[model samples]
Target: MTKQRSDEPEVKPFKGPAGGWGSVRSLADILPREHLGPEAYRELARQNKPDGFMCVSCAWPKPADHHPAEFCEEGAKATAWELTRLRTTPEFFAEHTLAELRGWKDYDLEQHGRLTHPMRYDPGTDKYVAVSWDEAFDEIGRELKRLDPKSVVFYSSGRTSLEASYMYGLMARMFGNQNLPDSSNMCHESTSVGLKAALGVPVGTTQLKDFKETDAIFFFGQNVGSNAPRMLHDLRDCRKRGVEIVTFNPLKERGLERFTDPQNPVEMATLKETAISTQYHQLRAGSDIAAIIGICKFLIDWDDLAKADDDLPVLDHDFIAQHTKGFDEFAAAIRKTEWADIERETGLAREELEASARIYAKAKAVMAIYGMGITQHVKGVESVRMIVNLLLLRGNVGKPGAGPTPVRGHSNVQGQRTVGITEKTELVPVEKLEAQYGFKAPREKGLDTVETCRGVIDGSVRAVVGLGGNFLRAVPETGAMEEAWPRLDVSVQIATKLNRNHLFAGRVTYLLPCLGRIEQDVQASGPQAVSTEDSTSCIHGSRGKAKPASPYLLSEPAIVAGIAKRILDDNPKVDWDGWVADYSTIRDAIEDTYPAIFKDYNKRLFTPGGVWKGNKASERIWETPSKRAEFLTPGEISATGFKDADGRYRLITLRSNDQFNTTIYGYHDRFRGIKGTRDVLLMHETDIAAAGLAEGQIVALESDAGDGVQRRRDGMIVTPYDIPRGCLGAYYPEANVLIPVEHHAEKSHVPAAKSVPVRIRP
Candidate 1:
């Protein structure tokens, strides 16, 4: 097949729930094209099951009882993608120069398949030539020693396992650098900031079992089918048990309305789909904060009426008085907030919000669930706090059926943060490292994703070392990044495949090949078993069985250790070589670093569904300064961006059904009725008509950040969709160019990709 983008925008509304015959057909088409055989099929069956490798896709939790076909559509695709027989070896890179590769599309570049050997960029010929692993490691060490350790940015993608990401960070901290930025900066950093203030923990408090018992779940800004299709099974069973699922988003996503269980033979035979959401609200873009505030106001005002009449009070007075604080101020703010403001900003009626509140009031327990929609905004942290406030009004936290849950994007992203991969130097525990490894750890402040962009442009960041991620493509203002990226002194990317970010070769760059999670990683000591923490905070051990794509490929831990060996030659206390040879030693070191959390690491992790890492919030142990869950509200909740200002539409960037982050799996987005291209915009038909534009008008989108910078994305086909009247949606990464790096959540600094002010032009 040839790599091609459609010339015209194709639009056809998909009428059924996500995942049914459509998914089965997709899998059938994908398996043959990827050249996967029966062995791959067998491996797919073992995926997400006990004693098997976890799915490398979304971080959705696996069920306790696993079945033969426990994976979802994207999970199978990811496996087939990794396990392909195709190999992008040294010969292939020799044929294509870096200059030529730069012009290729992202999908075309990645379709070349797995990286088989270490390759270094040759500046003379503008091509990548094969290099030995020893030379690659030595060159990286030499380059880092030349610059200040603080100037080197170490980035980890969501795909990294626990042992690898942990060791990677340890190497950075031991080298007196704290610039450990990972994928969290791009997605759910807002959850960390807001939840820390509200629940005293940055992670979700609920376990998989909570879904079975929860009476209701409020979903905000999440497209279930496209993001995490496996979650539909849980929603299916919950729906059968009469659980109310409420969704609030800018677009009317099909996954939220109804979902078909592909594994259910009876339902598939009858073509029957299970009803999912009881109420779905198409709220204005970036107005999750205001929409949720409306619900809080409705609940709080109703509680006032019940309290005044001496009837059954809707407020959880006992729980609030005992386990919460700042309730009076939070309620006062909600009550003082007018319904007109909420209705106007949310593009929702007072009656709709009140109706949603009635369902919440009647339910015994409700789970507050959200995705990037709630987090990637100017007020993302505030939006998360609002969710916490609404849940606290009903005594939802620390309960069996309820808590705040962020639908994280990557597998093991939460685990990466747990095991010391963050820019916040405080998370490193300097004294702890000194005692464990006899190194003086640096507490110097470091750059995040946004700061890294500034650092790259201003020449403060001398080098960047990535553990499996496309930095330039994933970051905001991609146009700016592409121009300034090559100015860096060094770039080292340890990845499984080729990507566009790899093309932005700095002055000196090395592309090192690393073993995928699906490949066997055998060391001198024995077979290695790495672990990853799912969204639920449960740790599962994953061991690969298939032969590696190439014998030259090394595990991520091995690669990190090789570099560490050269950089920290004098640090005898840290056993870099031994830890790589025996992954158990890394686990032992992880246990030493975080004894309270990773206690009995090896024994507990290798168990049947892995072990629970213990949620501090769920245990009702508030590690907060106030010694209780705090209700922190912003001083001012602005409602400006929710409505169109000066003919500028609020744009929300999203993923296609075929893509995962920056990795383009295919061109078709079956769930959204989009086929053959990702470069298109989704707007309400009313908005399209209002602008005197037809459905498929080719236009250029520009962001008015008022910074005198030209942030434009042209050749986008206007795709009128079932979105809010004043909002527009487009595929991410392509839309990333329009977002300014400085425009991010105030507290978390997550890229405000979900809410950027943009205007379309012909």
Candidate 2:
């Protein structure tokens, strides 16, 4: 790690914090809340077609025609963020030095407003100056021409349109480097890698319609309310139909317990909230495998007992026999897992596990939903595999409302990956690219976010081109990632807002501001519409309504076009200008490249509500060699509980209600009584009592592994809660300081945020 001064502001812990329902009420006043005037947003939010742009914040599926107030809290924030009246002109850039700008907070940087022009970083003056698009593009092209393809990493964000993402993929492929690391690596990479390895495809099995028909909903390690508020309506509707909703997490998040739908007029008028979960189980961090396995074992035992009494159907034996493999070996593994070990690890008694399994068994249709909590661990891939395995036991994959659902964080993350944003997978097949583009593209796999950072640190990486994302703050090893950015020969950013990543300048760095998703895209051809894929593999056209924040600002597609034209000048075969002139051509290219998935992409996007790229094998079609979903015989599973005085307590990192990924919207966490700050830990009362710490006690948490990473975050107020006895929870980015870059999932490179081992001290 590089030795450097920690210039980041030190946020003090909140003293005498209020607790309970009152805290949520108090938050309404502190957190930034302002409704768009009816006149200003009326035309924008109309259900009638103006443009078909989806919200760029979350992956919550939206109906083709939803009412005006159909948007949820997070959706409102995301939509409002794009439609913000703020602007960051060249004058603003001229005023703030790179070093001085680096000192601004994440929220402050975002609040400074959107970047309005193409600018180049002048290290000599330490400030950015406006530059012509051609000059910036030529500079980037010169660097690309000088360096080996492997020396450059092309990073992307989820907010990019499908056409832009596809073109960007083509650009990197043309450059002969597959180093296309995007935002996916940080959040749902495990789901994509793990689920695909286990089931031959990577996507959620359930469609939005499934929510209405589901008999039971089991959310594992996901907080739907804060993350995807519209999901509350589905859960609330399910509850009305007497459907059982259960939650399993390390912390008793308010989102999973109860939610007041702000969109509902009657509900909001009465200030009434609906209960989301009937039974909330607090599984200790890192204990998910044990708990899930224990439930499977209990179901097996219950089946045997039911068979003796002529009351069978304890499990879906027929589905297990017909559509899955290795169940018997997996059953044997579950039986061998000791009850005491299960309790010691999962912090759940056999009865509790049995109770949950019995309810699961009784339900006709069930959907097991999860998020980063299940994917951000060393065993994250295995954890996802296990969830699918459990679902397969009951033949949950194909049936409506009964399957594996990994709730994606960003709105276009799944879509971006599906289109092109990948370092490992090829966007266009090599043979196809060779034939169509007339270039012998590189077949070697590219570097993801982790590999890119490592490549830069080791001096292999020379340049980075970002397409709308904060790369440094988003990835782990903050120090390493930050240091490596400045060493790059050229850093190009095509973005909408000013972020921390812009401050990490290079020898020849350029910031090219692009149009937001809500802004209409006008090009050389005409006004264009871009497409994006959702979590369930649904592709739809997104058209922007608002005018560009600046006349000079370009849409993502045009920005990529400008760079590609300058770089691919000598290559007569490539038609960069034509692709950017009309987005439909890019869609045609996508169709030509990925025929199986994007077949007739141009025609289908215009179809009512777009088309769904069927996850055929993900529906339990079983594309594996055995032609069945294989149930792995997992090894003995146990977690190190707090009882082990050698200093081990499961630590879980979380995102705040006001924050989304590395982008901090505000400092207030209303539900937790945290205001203008983000430093605090929620611990179990028993653990606090045992540690001799009182409520509001400031404590230092040290990692048990002694990795020498900032092992301890001091001056944190220890608040007692109903969290699992052996685990603790804290907000990320701030708590990200505690996670080591190497401490990641074995298969997926995802940071082990949920299962970090630590000890708390007063």
Candidate 3:
């Protein structure tokens, strides 16, 4: 394995749906190498039974009653990983050099097999050699003890279980450091930052059940079917009830238009697809600010018309006067924005905007759902505020079926943030440490993912212990982070399989094999149940079924507990053994730490689903200074790089049907007719012709905002699409090459993945 790209043959266009059996056919080539056999596979599938274990793939809510084929296509791939027959033995690692492994494709790494045991890189041989778990722990402990607390950064992925995340945070705090930058730091940090500023909370306000009561759903920058297929069921249910679903995106995705659920037998057998969107608008990326402003302006105008004619209620005047502030400023700002500017930026006509506003005015309840598309802009935080402003204008925050929902990406990404996986200013994590372990936590807000990479490049940060995730590829400015890795003193990855980041090991690197979500987790006490927080802030348990692939596959919590005990100074109060032995104690500790939030964790979690928090606090009670939801007007519209560039396209990063976030299950993006390729851009035919480019022609995309950054991903096939004029879209991680690391929102450190300025050349 040298640093060569995957040499698989160019893929043919997607023919049809890869049904359960058809999907298995697609994996035929790799099945011999990756399949764990029928016995293991069946057990793995059984383990995915509703009561057995949660789906290791996406965070889509499961049905209360078990459905036989409940898992999605991507979920099956994740299950396959758990039940894979291949194993990464010490001998195999000894045969391949680190440099050689660097050439492997992203999929090939996972295809290699489950890592069997702990391994340390042997600089002499340029390959990894077997290392005893005890030895590896001792080595990491020694390296951590030597580095200054400030020079080390601990990173976690969304895959980490809640208990593991809490332990990781506790371990870092005990080591007198709060330099914790996690996966959430990259994706939904803007949601947290924006929602917290407007609604006094950082998480989504609505749950899945809320959709059942929704009268109207304003979906912004989200592809419901592709990103979250389970949501299609809810949307389909709503559609059946005559609920309106208005979709806004840069491109017209087929999944958004019609979705045939694999779980529904009637639809699956008849090959019938459910209609999803009632009104689909091709919103230009980066111009979301304009779209939101237009909605606000329409609301204001409706109010004025209502007042003059004595017709009806346009703005919720009663709600506004009783429960809000700063309306005059918001109203004045709305008045200042002209319809011409809104139409120009949003690429929507005045009539369409008016029609949408009319619907909003007439709706008794409205729910707005958004994803990375809305949060990955230079003015992303402001765009989020606009959504809040719209909701606040109608008293949508604490209602039954209405509120802002930022559809989260990862399984436990939201949980990780809630468990204190953050780089806070006061380093209050240390204060918690002192209260629990009798040690003062550091008093510095550490660098986030982007800042940590900068620190590594500048030599301020010398080491990183990533609990999980592909850091190099996931971070913006991949070239910089790749170069910076070699400069670090130590780098460690506690993971299940090899990823792109594992190959970019530093001077002192170690890959500690850990258990997957579906593998059996045996602790000193016995089998343990790991807790996870859903997108709705509901906590539940996940238990593994299949036997560990190897005796060495330790659970995440066990791995973290082992490292915590070995690295930190021994404290009687810090009972690492007790915590690892019984996860209930961890829950107990969590309850103690956030009693008002996690009261009766044990009793409540025992129920079939789980319990909800903030119910009492949500009823017309704001945590803000005034104890009421505030209407903060961003008086002036924030300008983005898109406005100044006349003909340049605003590129948005998207995940293919076969992918999830940064993880590429395979190259085939089935729904879009793309297969075995990441080197392609989706664009409007008009935009292509306007740029003097032809379909199927390869072109380089130059970014004016990327500050001369070069995208090595050349020769990308172009496909004529119904995207908005001057708007472009491409797969992320590859598109990460074009987005500069420094390009970020002012308030939130989230890199702009939605609104990027670029020009195409043939």
Please tell me which predicted candidate would have the highest lDDT against the true structure. 1
- Expressed as tens digits, the lDDT of each residue in 332-445 for candidate 1 is 888888888788788899888888998999999889889998889888888888889889888898989999988989989999999999988766666887898887888777
* Model 3 C-alpha lDDT per residue in residues 339-394, reported as the tens digit of each score: 88788877888877777777787788899998888787777788887888888888
All candidates' TM-scores? 0.98, 0.92, 0.94
Pairs in clash, predicted candidate 2: 53-543
lDDT of 2 by residue, 1-762 (tens): 111122332333333212223333433432233233342264346322324567777777666555555556566566656666667898887787989988777777776566788999998889999988888888888877788878888899987778888888888888788888887887888898777766777777777788887888888888775687667777777887898987888776777777665556676667677777888888878777888888788788777788888896677889888887888888778878888888877777778888888788888888999998888877788888888877877877788778888998887888878776787753436787779878877878899876776787777899999998888777766666777779888899888888889999978899999888877788788888888777767787877767677888887887888888777646766677787788898898888878988888877775554578888664568666777777766653632222344457777888877777766766665555456556678888888888788887778877665656556678777877668877788877766556666667777787777777777766
Q: Whose TM-score is greatest here?
A: 1
**Number of colliding residue pairs in model 2:** 1
Q: Which sequence of candidate numbers ranks them by TM-score, best first? A: 1, 3, 2
Q: Which ten-residue region of model 2 has the weakest summed lDDT?
A: 1-10
Tell me the deviation in Å of residue 649 in model 3: 2.5
